[model samples]
Target: MRRAAVGSCPASKRSTLSLDDHAVGVGRARAQVSDVGRQDDPNARVGLHVDFWTVDDPDEARRLLAMGADGIMTEQLRRVATRGAIVAAMVRLTRRRFTVGAVAMASGACGGARAGEPWSEEPPPSRVDPGFMPAPPAPPSPDPRLAFAPVARDAAPPRSIWSWTTAEQATEIRRDEVLFTRESSPTLGRGHLFDVLDARAADGDPAAARLAGVELAKGRFGWSNPWATVRGATPGETYGLELLHIEMRPDTWFARVRTSHEAIAFVDSAGNAVDRGAALDSFERVGGILFEHDVEYTGACATTGSGGGGLIYREIYVGNEARLATFSHRTAAILARLEGDIAELSAFRDWLRYGGGDGWSAYSWSCIAAQLWRSAPSTSRERYLASLAFATDPYAPYAASVDAIVTELKKASFFTPDDPFTHAP
Candidate 1:
């Protein structure tokens, strides 16, 4: 049972030593032992115990044993404890290939557990297997609408030339037009002119109507399919709809157009066009303006005993201000401190640093209002609130996040100083 061991070393550093080097080191150490009685006893022996923080995999562990390792000492879950003594070189092997999962799977269970449950054994049936891997779903089809008209890779793409000398501000004008050429089409002029045409004419949108008007003015009246003809106008005369500030992110495509009219930006899984202007005037008749504000958003799950939910503070616009007559406990608390002042509300919202801001969650309406009220005149504050109160939606897309905002709006009330605010979940 006489054992000689080396402390644990990282895999990379240990890889540098060859088997001959390890054997030589162990032999040198064993040769130094001078117990005459032990030397005479054939049963008495000394061996090297190589230490590792983690075995790379089950196969690596078996290889280490075959490489003349008297024993392997590892911090991995394979070790067992009996009456506080850790016993190594156990048969238990992890199903996963990494040490990270090995530690996570066993660490939590080793602490004080329930009366009948022993910490040394595998976790209960309810525990999820860290090694279990899920199969990836099939890849989705590409959207045909996203097909870009090709141009020579070496040639510079035509830029949108704008009238910089005009009195019109850049904010008021749509300046992101791209010169539309047949070569620019993803189909490479393989499809007919009608292929690029709008399936239907713009109903009442002034912006869309103006573009449609330009198509008709090009002597395209005699054309049997006007919509496609309009879409197939001359390169300089027509622009890609994509040039319109379609704010695209890794996961979302938010157009520069009115939010209510966002349906124009829809693309199927295959990147094909579905419908444009489908959400036009969708929220115009819904009544009440959308407003943005922060609330103590919370939720919980009993299965995992995990509690607490994060705040919903990013671009959360609530529809129907009038429906806010029934305020929730959280909303009521926020309103009670504002004293019906608009400037304070503005400061409170502007100060919010969405993901992380120091003490951002502890902000009070009254303190924020008093600090910023002097910065803006009463008239300005009144106008800002008025704008928020009358905000209109022309591109209202159906989404759970948007739906939640609308639901909260229906339960929130306008902040009134005199009204007694009470907690009601």
Candidate 2:
């Protein structure tokens, strides 16, 4: 179990040196190997096993081996091991065939010559044993899942969303448009539309699943069906309702459907769906209520000295205005609907306060407090305070905008010291 070490050789040398006398080993860096040199056959230098260090690239390892490296030290151990296994398998297969061929040749030569006589120019004829016939090659196994049934080109198959219109070649352009793009037939109604979409979704159609989820969340058909559909949905198909606040549990599906009325730019940051006008309207409606003073915008909010004094009044219509407006309008709409539902409100508040663990989640919570005061000033104020008290930890990251809204609301005359809303669980 002797250990070998790697050391550098002199710049003038053109080959690797093994210093067994000093009990030292020498190796080269990639650059050093090219400069101080490489041997055409480093293995020919007896008592030496050339090893390269820190090799991670597959091509670089192959190049080093071609240049006579006996082994390599790599951080990517799994990759190297996998390659070695593949090479070993190929060698084993070749060796088995080589052994068989060698035995066949030996048998022929043994039968041809006598012990003292010279060998004949032509080889002895091979005799087949009457009782020993080689078995014929095995027939290929057919796959049970596949069948090849040919159909006539002119035949029309049964109508389906998954299959093309023709049995063979497509005869008309957009032949399947009626199945997907067109409105449901007058006799079928909207339920049929959803049925088709749901069928497609269950069969692993992402686009159909997404569309069905979005439409179901919209609740145009009614609340009962959407709730039932989403409740029964498997993880494989969330029906585009993956953004629902999970902390709400059994009712989270309904919350997701309820909140769909307000457009939430869940993934995008460009504020493409943000309505700046609606946000300004919300701010105008609730500014005086939250601040408890005349709401007027001064340039002070943009400066560090403004502190928490100006708060929502100065910031709402300033930097990231569209985002603020969008958040205000969307959250306020959703919160307004949950006014009397204390259990749902608490769950929603928990999601807003604690879900900012990642960049996208943090951004989603940034303006969650926006326009909330405008929904129902007194109720909103109490709800906001209750949410703050419910938090076991500090507010999540990117919650400064939400904090500004809370700060402004604290100045109201109705602001209370104790929790405004309470429930057992």
Candidate 3:
């Protein structure tokens, strides 16, 4: 696993946070950041999802508090000084709404289920009977061949597919691998990159125009139109468009078909146009084709900066619509074989968090960061900060998160702390 280097941001702007920066919240605001998106009322109570984790600096938290944050919702207490800093800041803000959840003390937030608490009212029971549920039927035993559980016994780990490298170099190298589908190309190659459409090619072209319109409709009505497809003249035969792969990134490459009016679209190789507000990388199973992210450089992504690149993982473009349905059925069998421990892991996660009681819900700020650092790519400074903060912490909880992630990773194969971000000193 490779960690993207911590890049610098302008001094005047918020400093770019690394993955190890951890700060814990003393309080838990019930409101989520998503609530603000629906209605930008700063006056209303809102919570920062990861705001209360441990961090070296309190400036970011202080700034957010100043902007009318109601309270900090956190799971664990950090260092005394860091805790003190957050407490001091919380005291300064007179407008914040405070609520005492039952577990607020361990979480370091103000509020609790005190007697006469306004939020402590109990609700009436539901009308449905609670004791009449039937016992679940036992699942059929799985075939031994289908199971690929992670081994528990200690052994030498499998070799990693690759080793450490910089994201810039990785991106450049991955870019070179994009092969374009040539005029005589029969099969789509891995590096074969092609543009869906261009400005000049789409302009005044009715086919391109229709696609553009569909794109607009997708934006306006998300997931509403299931029948949206290339309306007129497919790009391959109609436009005969070829891509300059050297310039295009895998995540950025897409096909576009013009239609009547000013409609234009970014489509997959199967000519399935992207819906509005949908990510291009998520264009999987378009016309029964499988797509996956091309680049392994899972780092912070931006509209302007680098993103996870893309490549056509499989080509399943059967000519007939009826045949496509059959192909889709066959593809399911293949995907079933490909699906790994995600389902079992997810079940474990739910059981631990929901059924394991109070202990499972709480985690050290640093530990959570460390787990995330090893498990997923950081796409924002905030996430990086949490990872870095937790990774560096000396606390037991920090170790717990790290150990948990390692254990989970080892379930499928042997685990190694090779990535610089997660390497334990």
Candidate 4:
């Protein structure tokens, strides 16, 4: 004779399936299954199947299956049978005034009963029983700070695939920037190299714009007035310079060229200049230019700067060896950032479309944003800005909120989980 016990208790507190070779019983208590009673048990007393009872939630059923349960007994046949339709419908409902919690309850109850509670003869509450649960309050209005304002199509182009910078590429870029800044002079004559490059940049030469932007950012060739230098330059030039200024050393040269819009210096929470990854920022900005221009360069093999005196003229034809290296390195970094941003955005969008309707998706988004705010607020801001530029309609609100929150976060010197600015909500 084989024995089994079927019981109900808080799923978190106790198991619902128990079996042995003796007698069968059902009650609200902790389950005890012997190895011999399990079908998979090597020393088997009986070939017993482990099944859970009264599982109304499809999510719970899935969880049980993962835990090696043989079968599940769920009352709501339609919900379990039409899981896809229910989830899709819930997504539609979430767009309305109904709270995510309400939709979750309408699908299925998460737990069987409270711990130590006795089973009652009364029937289980109806899955959609309005009488069992009060009407959920309407969702709060969108935060004023996160209010969506559509940017121009030209300004925020559709998302595109991008690759990450490799270690070798990064090393090459750093080497180039350092060597170029040391060896090359931005002067061709009294007029300066920028005078010609600036005109070329205006004429839509991405390479020229990039070179000129880097020189202007470094305050080379007697370049003063950051805004004035870039005033007539291309959009790529302006953005590239802005990125450079954000991480450039704040010295006499930087001071002479820094715009009012640019930060005096990027610093950590302790007010110390963040120098550890500063070089990477420079590289990334340069990379952005290359990506915008859709240009490619081979690594160190691409340029020969050591040949002879004709090197200066060769640079004018191509680009400064150092500048070219930095360009390639930074381009790789920009591609990496884009790749990460796209992956995160895709996952977020999927969550919005097919996430559990128990408000966990929204909660997780807030948590991730908060974590990024604490660890890398600037990165968070840049990511959101990218998201705003690239995200589709379904996820625009989330991106906008994060963008707004970054502004608030920038005002604070330190961060805590409880900080109001840490989360978009």
1-425 per-residue lDDT for model 3 (tens digits): 11111112122321111121112234222211111121233223212222222222356346434533212222321111111111111211111222211111101122112222222112212311223211222232221122222211111111111111224433433445312112222232221211232343344544333333323221110000100110101112111111011111122213322111133344443334556335333433221111111223333322211122221111111111221111111122222322333343333333222212122112233233333433542322223222221122121122223233333333313222232121110
User: What are the per-residue Cα lDDT tens digits for candidate 2 across 1-425?
Assistant: 12222223333322222212111122222211111122232211111112223233456445545634322221011111110011100001101110001001111111111222222222233422222222322232221211111111111111100111121112111233111222332332443335544766687755345545533222111110111122111112222221111011121111111111222111112112224344333322211000011122233322222122222110000111111111111122223322323333333333333321112221222133222222232333223422221111122212232332233222211222232211111
Q: Which candidate leads in TM-score?
A: 4
Model 2, C-alpha of 301: deviation from truth (Å): 9.7
Better of 1 and 3 by TM-score: 3
Residue 118 of model 3, lDDT score:
28
Which residue segments of model 4 deviate by more than 4 Å?
1-93, 96-132, 139-396, 399-425
Full-model lDDT for every candidate = 0.22, 0.22, 0.23, 0.25
Predicted structure 4, TM vs. truth:
0.23
lDDT of 3: 0.23
For candidate 2, the lDDT comes to 0.22
RMSD to the hidden true structure, all candidates: 26.1, 30.3, 23.1, 21.0
| Candidate 1 worst ten-residue window by lDDT | 389-398
Task: Summarize candidate 4's per-residue lDDT along 1-425 as a digit string, tens digits.
Answer: 22223223235533132122111122111123122233333222311122223223456435544644312221011121111010101112223221111111111122222333333222233423332233333343332222122222122111121112224433443555431232232222322345555666687755455545644343222111111122112112211211111122122111100111112223222233434245234533221121111111122311222111121110001112232222222333333433343344444323323211222221133233222222322332223322231121112223222232232223221222231111010
- Candidate 1 has an lDDT of 0.22
TM-score comparison, 1 vs 2, better candidate:
1
| Distance from true location, Cα of 205 in model 4, Å | 5.4
TM-score of 1: 0.15
Q: In candidate 2, what residue range of length 10 has the lowest lDDT sum?
A: 82-91
